[model samples]
Target: MTDTLLNEICALETALQQSQVRNDRIRLDGLLHESFEEIGRSGRHYCKATVLQDLSHALKAWHSAASRRMRRESAAAHSPQD
Candidate 1:
């Protein structure tokens, strides 16, 4: 690919990664094609819908875990020292 095309592709990839990390569903929806499909390394098939669903679930789990950690730390910080 030409340098300009290569740069554009790289930029799109970086944008995709950032969107996923930030859980920006709107951005993802815009970036991914409706018929997008991926065959994972394990040979599992995933479509656009499946990928988005997985990301949503993962984001929920991550937030839950982070909240729990924050609560534990807060409790420990407030508790009297031994």
Candidate 2:
């Protein structure tokens, strides 16, 4: 990956970590969506098949993580664990 793309991904990862630390689901979800879209746009701009594939994988990973987080929170809220 290019330095710029790596930096962008790092920044997004940092933001995601911070959001999780703050328990800000709304902001976290928003950032996840934004990052996914940004990666998609980047792939389109780069016009590299490998980059596009990587971006798709990253997007799917982020989406899965976000979904898992949401489910965990919901379960905790409804369970006696909270």
Candidate 3:
């Protein structure tokens, strides 16, 4: 691909990542094509609609896990020596 096309693709990829991180569903809808499809590692298939629907649930679980991990680390950091 030419440099200009490559740059555009890179920028779109960056936007998609940012949207996923931020859970920006509207932006994701705009970025993703209606015909998008994915074959996940588990051999399950997902399409654009399913992915958008699942994103909220996935992000919530991720946030909750991260929060718990941080709390554990913080408690460890603040624990008194034996």
TM-score of each: 0.77, 0.41, 0.58
lDDT of 3 by residue, 1-82 (tens): 8999999999998886674543877788888899999898999998999988898788789899999999999999999979
> Once superposed on the true structure, which residue ranges of model 1 sit more than 4 Å away at CA?
1-10, 17-22
- Regions of model 3 farther than 4 Å from truth: 19-22, 58-82
lDDT of 3 at 49: 91
- Write down the RMSD of all candidates, one decimal each: 2.7, 11.6, 4.4
Candidate 2 local lDDT, 10-82, one digit each (tens): 9878876562532544454455543344345445542234434555676688889999999999988899752
Name the candidate that leads on lDDT.
Answer: 3
The C-alpha lDDT values of all candidates are 0.85, 0.62, 0.85
Better of 2 and 3 by TM-score: 3
Pull out the clashing pairs in model 1: none
Candidate 3, residue 19: Cα displacement in angstroms equals: 6.1
lDDT of 3: 0.85
- Reference-based lDDT, residue 80, model 1: 100
List where candidate 2 sits over 4 angstroms from the true fold: 1-47
